[model samples]
Target chain A: MVPSEAKKYLSKEQFIHQAFSYLEKGVEPTVKTLWLNDEIQEKITEILEHSYPKLRLRYWQHDDQTVWFLDEIGKERPISFGISVKSQRINLVKVLEFRESRGGEIHMQAFTEQFDQIKLTDDNKLNKHIDGITGATMSVSAMKKIARVALMLDKEVR
Target chain B: MKFKLALVSAALLACGTVNAAEPTNQELLDLIKSQQKEIENLKKSVEEADEKAEASVEAAEKTMSNAADSKLSFGGYGELHYNNIEDKESIDFHRFVTFMGYEFNEDIRFFSELEVEHSLSGDGKPGEVELEQAYVEIDVTDATSIKSGLFLVPVGILNETHEPPTFYGVERNPVEKNIIPSTWWEAGAGVTTELAAGITADFAIHSGLEVPNDGGVYDFNIRSGRQKVAKANADSFAYTARIKYTAIPGLELAASIQHQTDLTQGVLNADANLYTAHAIYNVDGFGIRALYAGWDVDSEQAELAGQDKQDGFFVEPSYRFNDEFGVFARYSEWDNVAGNSIDTEMEQTNVGFNYWPHQNVVFKFDLERRDGAQDGDGFNLGVGYQF
Candidate 1:
């Protein structure tokens, strides 16, 4: 697989976005999403070495042999998106977590068919997710993804 | 003077210089030799000046170098609590909680809070020592920072924001402690960010240990018995989230939730969940705070802790008479309706006074009463400090 192609069109964020997009559009993401994450991580390291260079992906596997990819990145601090696919349907969950604070979490609705995966959980939920922080939704959102990605990548290899 | 002239003439002859001179000629040669020596010394001084200039330029470049290197700082705070109960069956309670922190830099730091319940570290003693909160943090910016290791969830007022002086009386609110789990810290990492004016949010995934009510405290720290919060296809992990709003100046409000899957993978191992809402308001040294929390567990072990669906709330109002003196009262209630222990309810009331002669030190006296479950209460006096 050419890692360079995925890196060209997708920022690491874009790769994660596409992962959810496929799930929303009722299409299954190939193993390529995993490869895309690695490629972007490598490219990012070349440019932004001090920042975290890894992306994690997660999926939902239930008891009925049904497997759905979770678009959510990690459960730890640095929130991420959740993606799942089952019965021609994709479910996306947005989750957030912080280091010292408690209970600031936000989750958004499932997106399907025409909507891009760029949607946020909502201002009320975002406000709730951040607790007392103000004017940093985008940063909080990105941290959610990093948290999700770390969780996802850890899952894939294990 | 003659001796010097003779030496100069000899020196010039050795250097392939023919000295055909009278007495005045010798003196002129000596002056020339002295001038040459002076020039050599001047050259050495000029070379030293050039070296010094280069060194100064190097020092300037090193200024920002140390700026990026992490700065280390150490700080800590502690709590000494006391309680007095009006009931004849009551026993007084006292405890201490101290936290020491090291900030490596604005980017990262480490903090740990140690607790001694009843001032002993034994099964049946006056106190117990515990590493209450321990964690490492990597701050990305003022608005966002990632933290890992073990720490408290930002679900309510008492869990993460509990400092002795910050609260009114000896013990934390009942709703926050039993219902929301005060001093509840786990192993995980999450982020913190500001949402808008007077609002902030936090969430995390942490290690969840399944300790039955009968399970001793030691059960929480053992290998194989504990679970690591993993991403996917992993056996152990718990997800947590919290949001807070402070738009009301001295008034802060928050809500939080936590969920975990089958912890021990045994008979009746079920998911566990908790939710809470909290508020604190301070108007003109008259402070008031309230909290509500609920916990549910679908596990066989739930019976041991009487874990059904438990909901509780508390309201506290305090008035500061002056900078060094204040009086406060707190009322708390909890109801447990799940599990095998049957339905149980608890209520507590506390009246206390506080005196602070110094900014970092405080003294407190509290009288408390408990009714229904756990039928014990007492009075206590205490002192605490932070630095």
Candidate 2:
């Protein structure tokens, strides 16, 4: 993994294009798209137990690191996760934002740290363990599913 | 002051003593020594400054992180029901519940559930206000946790997770409600350990139940023995243990056993033991559920009264057409007095449908047929929500 990779999208808001800055100060990140065809959509449905919200997903890449800003429902509200993949493994995972009334414990560093350096296996399963919180089972499950999605997407980009 | 003067005088003598622009060895030594001392002081000062900066950064990070992680979250669910049975009809606000949770840090948390049953509580009223669950859970490690306070016993599928929309039927299933006793809790301390894969085990010791003897109260009913962790007699205690496997996606299997030293609280030398097991499997919107629970009361009077051995089992097969609609049929049979031949067993069949306008809100309707001890036909309609 390259520790000193040039980061064009410095903050999470900038990475997800949620922040507005001086137009001359920053160039728009070069975005790429992955369309959810029947085959890929089926695989994603198997991973998430639900369909993707849109037909295509937009992501950003810098050197060997790629970023995915994804959303999944936790109980009744959607939770957004910012996942970074480097060299086909998880480089970082963070809760960019949360809308659920409960299950905020999933954003704790002790819990999110478990995803670092993890990758998908031959059968497309996580190679590491993700522990579930006492009252945040659904939220934890959502995070795991998003992690797998990011890894799979990384493989496609590669 | 002498050192500074000697250094200045050495410099002046060195300039006059340098006939060929070269200073004496002693002058050079004094100059280098003084310069070296000045460099050491700068290095020391920089080191201290760096330490202070790092400490300040650490404090800022800790504050921001804790503000994000230590949260107080609230959620709740409520249900209203209408049931008509054998020409008798009743419409009631069944339950109003509130849940509160506070995360003290990454390792400690507090949770509580408060409920109002039948929607009212007062003198000569048929409702009650109860604290069904309250506990503080401390993480001993990433894989293990210990909790203490009043908590629902980890015995059956619904006892620990019984939001109205999460389950089928208007009322709780009879087997869990009558035999294992749904919504049962006690003040106790327990440890939960998660092992490899998705396996978990729990063990706890808590207050026991006290069933009045025949002369004072009915002995055949096990559901009436609940003390609800109120200010009551605690001459003896109960121990419970459970283990579950959930490694396989969309599947869960679990079993629990509880032993009570005495259920009569020294009233009849009576004690009762309970055993329960359940399985749930779901795939592609199709699901099935099965459970069995039994009780063994060790008292001569309990046996003579034909209520020593009480047990039941139920199976339900359900299919979800989509996220918003589902249907199911269940068969349940239970007997509170099975110690001897008494023909008191009750068998029932229920068919139900649940409609979810939103994931957290649901509308439910079901029809039931009761045979064996009681013969009747009834149907229930309800609406429930959780947020």
Instruction: Report the lDDT tens digits of candidate 2 across residue range B1-387.
Output: 999999999999888877756778999999999999999999999999999976876576466344323367677889999998887899998999998777665567777889999988999998999999888887776567788999889898888878887788888899998888888999989988767445788999999887767664566477888899889688889999999876654567899999988888877777778999999877666788899999999988889878789999999999887768999999999998888786988999999999998656899999999999989999999999887
Displacement of residue A59 (Cα, Å) in model 2 is 5.4
lDDT per residue, candidate 1, B1-387, as tens digits?
A: 999999998898887544464458778899998998999899989999989976775575355234322233233556554433544432333445555555554356776776666655676666656666777877676456787877776677766655565556766677766666666666778887767645677888876655433465432111223332222123556788888775543456788888866545443456777788877766556777788887676665554555546678888898876557889999888875434365477888889888888534788788878887757667767776654
For every model shown, the clashing-pair count is: 79, 0
Chain B TM-score, model 1, reads 0.69
Residue B196 shift from truth in candidate 1, angstroms: 2.2
Per-residue lDDT of A7-101 in model 2, one digit per residue for the tens? 12235765444322223456554578777678777878878876666556778776666778887766544677888887899978887665443
The parts of candidate 1 lying over 4 Å away from their true place are A1-158, B1-70, B79-98, B116-127, B213-235, B263-267, B299-306, B337-343, B374-378
Off by over 4 Å in 2: A1-66, A69-137, A140-158, B1-70
The 10 consecutive residues of candidate 1 chain A with the worst lDDT sum are A1-10
Least accurate 10 contiguous residues by lDDT in model 1 chain B: B219-228
Judging by TM-score against the true structure, name the best candidate.
2
